[model samples]
Target: MEILPADLQLYLETHCDIEPEALKKINRDTYLKILKPHMLSGHYQGRLLSMLSKMMAPSRILEVGTFTGYATICLAEGLTETGFIDTIEINAELEELLNQHFKSTNVEKKIRLHIGPAAQIIAGFDGPPLDLVFIDADKKNNLLYFALVLEKVRPGGLIIIDNVLWKGKVYGDAQDTDTKLIRELNDSIAANPQVEKLILPVRDGLLLIRKK
Candidate 1:
């Protein structure tokens, strides 16, 4: 759920830098071809991801969810010449769609897609410390993913968790599984002394956590 009104969202999009041509095409295609296009990060969030990546300029980025590859491409913008991004998506059906777009993008060389449970895949990555980590996959596993990636993320690196608001259900009376899980994750992050966090009510809600 959006925190701002429609007019405000439109104004924000108009004022921010637009996404690259390739991302635009990919986003459109994903919405048209995919069954659940809403899962793909649209323009505004994509631009935010790109901006964060640019600011971090991380050498290694680990993304827990790679739905349609929109955010993957956005995050790839911040990589150094030889930088790399490892993105994991549990849905095998999106593999072909993701690879199709990945092949057509300029940052194709920087992204590596892993299809499987992120929990298992993350265990095998023995690479260098991550400069940035994005968690947007299974809601129930947010804390699990965060713990798994914490060891790999460099000191002061960033960890962005998407869908923390759960479409305003977080603040409502609903007690569904996903809602409870997100609430637990949010409270845990807030209480954790290892990092500093802020919940930006942007597109659902983005929890920006910085390792201390």
Candidate 2:
């Protein structure tokens, strides 16, 4: 249920910046070997994530979903030399596949994959406040995850949420439960005074929030 026209999508891809050589390979391989290849953030969004990460130079990052590890790797690009990224993926079935690709990349040391419910796993970590948090897991628990991580993210840190647009169904006549939930989450972020938010039209929709 893509909201963008085919021509526009193609144009966006063509005109936007491309990913690095390693990311290019990972992106291609994920599509060919992964079950839900579309979940992999492609060139445009990947580049955006990488650029944001680089700009922030975060010491610690929290990724709520690691669907094939594409976005995880992208976010890791901006970490400090000794920094780390704690990424969670509920699907244990993709563990071997994700590990295989992760091992093949240089950022493997920086990414720690946790296989289980994100909320529960994140609750157990007693590490330093996260410099960046990317939420792309279950839509129904978006707000829950946000609340759980709110304290974990330091002031001025970034929290990025994906699929906020829900294929533009948020503004349409009617939407399924997931779409409605996403719309609600967007509104919740918009109304929250503790953070500054910006919703970008990048692939699907990405909400960038800076904790205050």
TM-score of each: 0.95, 0.94
Collision count for each candidate, in order: 0, 0
List per-prediction Cα lDDT, in the order shown. Answer: 0.90, 0.89
Residue-level lDDT for 52 in candidate 1? 96
Can you tell me which runs of candidate 2 are displaced by over 4 Å?
1-3
Candidate 2 lDDT over 59-129, as tens digits, reads: 99999989888899999989999999999999999899889878877899999999999999988988789
Residue pairs of candidate 1 with colliding backbone atoms: none
Clash pairs detected, candidate 2:
none
Write model 1 residue lDDT over 95-212, tens digit each, in one string: 9988989988889999999999999999899958999999999888899999999888899999999999888899999998889999999999999999999999888899999999
Name the regions of candidate 1 deviating beyond 4 angstroms: 1-6
Give per-residue lDDT, candidate 1, residue 206.
96
| Candidate 2 residue-wise lDDT at 171 | 77
On a 0 to 100 scale, what is the lDDT of residue 5 in model 2?
Answer: 75
